[model samples]
Target chain A: MASSNTEPVIIVEGLTARYGEVTILQDVSFEVYRGERFMILGGSGCGKSTLLKHMIGLIKPHAGRVVIDGVDITRADEETLHRVRSRIGVLFQADALFGSMSLAENVSLPLAEYTDLPPELIREIVRMKLGLVNLAGYDNHMPSELSGGMRKRAGLARAMALDPTFLFYDEPWAGLDPVTAAELDILIRSLNEGIGTTMVFVTQELASIFSLGQRVIMLHKDVKGIIARGTPQELRETSSDPRVNHFFNRQAD
Target chain B: MPEMNHRGYRLHVEGAPGAQAAVRLEGRLALEDLKALMADLQAVPVKMKPREIAVDVAGVEYLDSAGAMALIEMENLSRSLGIPFELLGVSEKDHGLLCLIDREALQRPPLRPESERPAIVVRLGEVARRQYRDVLEIMTFVGELVAALAYCLVHPRSIRWEEVKFYMKRAGADGLPIVALISLLLGLIMAFMSSLQLKQFGANLYVANLVTIAMVRELGPIMTAILVAGRSGSAFAAEIGTMVVNDEVNALVTMGFDPIRFLAVPKVLAAMVVVPILTVYADFFAILGGLIVGITGLDLTAFTYIQQTKSSIRVFDFATSLVKAVVFAMLISGIGCQRGFQVRGGAEGVGMSTTSAVVSAIFLIIVADSAFAIMLHYVRH
Candidate 1:
């Protein structure tokens, strides 16, 4: 057991999120420890993305709170939220890169906006971040000029531009070939192991969840909350819930 | 141990006679206290000038990326000044952060020099090349539209009558109120201004001739076409541009349907048919405005004003305006559809295409009107 003195970096308590009259997620609770790769797993329409958004403070929860480093993000003011947001980075599902900017400009945006660094130093940092993602010399290429996998890597580079403490990825391997997906998985693991930055990934891909996650929380649309939580080995070997077993074993209902 | 406290942060330096100097930092080291922390760190090398510096961050309660960057900068400065530097006693959280900084720093590539902007002649050549490509694309679009029209003529049943009616109502009936309002006001202003000049010489009766001939020959078609270009042309570009962005045009192509036939033809045919009818309305409204001016401002009876207007406008003048209306409609719809098909990227692309459609349509309308004016002058001679 971890020591009680070491506080969890993120504590999401009884979070209930809704869009209009439709409740997407309810009573969802989880904790992400420092230096851990946490995975949110569910099938389509299970509100994984919504949960991620609530955690990021992009969407206000219908109820409950997300406390990051002992500060409740749901109730945090703009100043507090800005500080919290600057410490974390989110990679959207669509990559959501600024369509008008080249890869270098996209990667440089957070640094430029947050710091008072000179342009020369900012450019050097941009090249370094892009290099980390294996896109070293493609600075002049626009987002439209990049392939799907390259754009995702660029988005990842942009996310890490400020050396954020917590990184959130929404479907990092959603639309990539097997080779590129494995490459990204390797990159994610290396980044986590090398830097120890806390990572939270939302994905339904069994391979990715097994490969990258240190701990996993499974959500269900029918339950409208987390249905199961455990490590991949534990879930695979000891879980008795039919849905959990079926999901882990890849058995169709 | 000697410690310096500033802005809620502390830095303690410990040095031995033959051992490396050690610096301990504590408290919140975030953006707010970054400048003070940097200033304090800068004084270390100047004051003690240690041959080797080791920073201990075990007591740091909070450290953001900005703090890490400042620390890295200090490390780099110490190294550059021939002082070896190292970080010691970093906690798990701080170690993670410092590791990120160290990794990024090690991987930091040399910055490339900014490329100079190309020479003016090179820029001009690029623009000319783009314009030439645009002209070719436009010509190809015109040819495809003509072929689609020919196909429709051959097989009348294949024509999308429903789409034609939809676009007709959207382009013509939906735009009627604004077009009528602007045309009425334009005619009123023209007649009022011309009457001010004609009344000076007892030639106020000629105001009726001036308004009628001008409205029928040039102003009516041009004004109606400009209004339609602003309204319907922009709409066409935006609607089809969005469709193109969403890959609906590609879907149509994959389904063995020409987008020109399915999309562009209905808009062009509708514009060609409705603009001429709108031009006739504009001409009538302008003549009525002249009649009003002649009666109220010139002390002439309404019948005399109507008779003067009727005699001034010939069949040739009316036909020429209708012909101009057709040409203007073709330009408006053609350019609008062409711009729509050229849409790339996303929502911004749609907006650019819409604006380009309106501007290009108006420009082509004026150019075509001038060409018609030159031809008419020679024909009259």
Candidate 2:
């Protein structure tokens, strides 16, 4: 396995995204080293989704660059971007599961669209992915029927369907109960060990980020960007930045 | 008290020719006094146009946030009443002070000159919105449905048929009573209203032809389609709107399933399946209404009215209406569900989407009925 020191799997350099005159993200530079479970932490409207969109090539950077797997995604062709995306799994915030589709259909959608596998083989793979997420028996369930955690787990199952080397989880633990959140944390760790995939997470929930992020990157709302990045423990004791201190001091707010 | 009126300021509110209201005030004429003066001006006959409040604030000094907020309120109220509001006869120092405090209000874009102003973009939001007439939209919807059905066949279990049945019950079954009632009411209404107009000519028997022709050929299908659209169309929007607000739509998208295909497909299918049945229910009630009108108003027998209806109603007429109802149903359900899925906000979004769905469905149903009528006219000719 290539260590993070050898080369970074994802790099966002001085990236900015603007909606009309309002700049949501400004000049952010960060790297997700190979095999690292990277986390981006901020409150709502802090442009975390905007950052994710830029990193995943869904959006073009306004004034900078995003390089994923040695490709300059800011100016890359659609085919090139698709190839890069095919190698990564994205578990979006809200899980983004289709309400019209059953659990089995939702999990198997990616393979149906992108793979040449036969229907029987596809079904088997879908079953395996659901089994991994502990949603195997609920294949016929609609998204409306699933509990919030089960829906997220189902989304995770779909993400794992592609067997990608890099995974991005956007607020995987959000809106989940504490027990379900803990279960997601366990799933994240197990998935990391089992697939050895590089991971990046965006979340405001501090406990999961501290427990799951191999390295955490703190994004602040004002002009300064990427204010702090470090191991969770290192951030807890030695961080001197007031924003970092306030964030780590861990008030209920 | 009379001496206090004499010391009060002489204010000239300029530009509003018809709306000059005088204020009676007392003392130093501070900005607060001016504000009170403006408040009193509201009682004036400034209903038609620009209101002019000329305050002589020369006697007083200083304006703060409260003064500014009051002036802003005045500006807003005057604008709302279609009256121009201007301050005049004020000392230069006080004018500058007032302007400084109400800078935002002062700098708003003034009404444009007739030649330079951009023409108002006129949108009906209601007028001329028939799904059938908009061939491009119809084709796009059909294309989307085809894609969804194809996807379903490849992933049969992806759609929970039971959930679809749940929605179907709401959209189709629940809609029947309302659709039936409206169709019945419509038939009676058309028969009575047209008879009242035609009765002046002593042609009460023609009410039979009129009701039969109008109900079976036009009003029955059209009204039934609209009623269903309002009821079921709104329901579809609410269902999809709630799903969207709750993030179920996003979850589907993340899971590699297109929400349009998943949520929209089954709804379109259900509508395509149910609209014809609803139309049949509507037709039966409408004919019944016509029969009642014929018996009571004209002193005619129910037997004669039925005989006339049976003889006059063509198989083509019935089929055409059914065909129109199916098309209208598609129009109502498709537009409603599509608009619902487009909702963006949370709870308010669900409400907005539901309202839009009903409005669009009704509008589209009317437009579709007319277009179908025109088509039938041309084909028959």
Candidate 3:
């Protein structure tokens, strides 16, 4: 991993997002520094997913800017935006694997499309990526045949195909059992440590946030912006806000 | 800082006695440049190899997973030749991503070649078995639909009257203008063609008889059925397929409601009611088309043409066609609903089911029409 630098890889300034008449997020500003595991935490219906989408340039915010690697993605031209996007990878909540394709084919898609490599080499890379997720030799299986946790793992393998410097995960362990969820957490932490890739993860799982997140921001539906920001241990021990306390303590508020 | 470029990837090799060989890499190291990198590395002789190889990556502007794998593969090759390999000057970002690559998996032998093709007989047998199973499944679906209909008849209040009305408007009322226009054009074409043959025999007066019989007995019912199959059959399949994919059908089952009754019944009933009505309109327009030819080509009056058509057609002819229309409607909507319920996977599944619904409905309609024609022919004789 790169040494912890003062320079941030991503800068979101006064971002306000809306869908038609309904406002989703307002004035959401944050800087994601290089080599940090940044976690976005919130309850259901909060704008965590919306904020992630804005960061990846999937959805444009109604106001303000998101600067990624020195380029303002909000105002970048299609070509420039595409160049920026090539450096980042996202795993959606649904896994969103192409259902018709086998696991190997799914993982090989980005490499095949973007590079002029021999088919033999691409096939080898696909195997290595799948192996990273502990899915070796399951390449020929269709996405529909995999269990939910396995499917999510396959999705992660596909996301890592390009070896993106920045990775964003949306609820990586949402539907998995406790054991599988913990296994996924361990995999994520190892990947962060071993590869030193910058990660921005959106999750409501308190256990995962506490264990894996280096820095955390809690979004609230009522405020439509971040209400708490700190290291997970700091928030748990020193935060004065009742909601933050309630969250860390697992109280029904 | 000596500049070196080879196949879009710059490589500078430095070797000294009793020292590790330093290979400086620059430019973008990605999948596109893998072939050149592999060839260049292979060109180095194994006899002169040192104990360790230092790969300097500081000048490399960009590196992806493929590039990482290339380095790993090179490392494995060096180890095989009794040499240790190490990467030097890797940026923090590149190092992080490169570490995620599982070196053990990368060193595995290339994937086995695809399996051999199956024998022709085996392939044919498999297809036949699949089609047979599909037929059995459709038969079971029809039986379930009939049971649901029987239940609805016994309990009149169970029918979803609102959905029936909605489908009737969509499949019947909304379909009216297009159906009428197409039927009218068909009638005009039939009258115009037959009039030419009749006129050659100086028998233009018989045009009314030919047009009336042809439209009522065959064209009117068959054309109406085909139009409805294309319009509403595909819609039923697509709608139900989407519901199946969305798990709405499963939800209905869990809620103690029969999916066939709640979804398919209304569509079937609406088509059954509306298709016959459209056939009658088609028959009327056909007779009018024949009358136009009679007035213009045969120098006959409107009164004369009407009298000829009325004398030539019987009530049995109209009743037979209407009966055919009703049966066609049932087949179209039933097959559509069945195909929808068969959908699996995702959006592509829905699309496939929709296309199959129209094709199967049309095929069944034509087959049923042939059976009706053969039975009617024997009875008439």
- How accurate locally, in lDDT, is each candidate? 0.85, 0.71, 0.86
Candidate 3 lDDT, B86-153, residue by residue in tens: 88898887887677777877655434434468999999999999899899989999999999889988
Taking the tens digit of each residue's C-alpha lDDT, what string does model 2 give over B342-370?
Answer: 77745666788799888878877877777
User: Which is superior by lDDT, 2 or 3?
Assistant: 3
The list of candidate 1 runs beyond 4 A from truth reads: A1-36, A54-84, A190-198, A223-226, A229-246, A251-253, B1-9, B12-21, B28-50, B61-82, B91-113, B202-206, B239-248, B284-309, B344-351
Which numbered prediction scores highest in TM-score against the true structure? Answer: 3
**How much of the real interface does each model capture, measured as fnat?**
0.10, 0.00, 0.43
Candidate closer to the true structure by DockQ (higher is better), 2 or 3: 3
In order of listing, the candidates' clash counts read 0, 15, 1
lDDT of 1 by residue, B76-127 (tens): 7788778888887777766665555444443444344335799999999999
The window of 10 residues in a row where model 1 chain B has the poorest summed lDDT is B105-114
User: Which whole-number lDDT from 0 to 100 does residue A184 have in model 2?
Assistant: 88
State the displacement of the C-alpha of residue B145, model 1, in Å, after optimal TM-score superposition: 2.7
Residues A94-132 of candidate 1: C-alpha lDDT, one tens digit per residue = 999998888889988998888776776677667756766
Badly placed stretches (over 4 Å) of model 3 are A1-3, B1-3, B6-9, B15-22, B26-32, B45-64, B81-99, B107-116, B195-211, B284-312
Q: Please report, as a residue range, the 10-residue window in candidate 1 chain A with the lowest summed lDDT.
A: A1-10
DockQ of each: 0.24, 0.01, 0.40
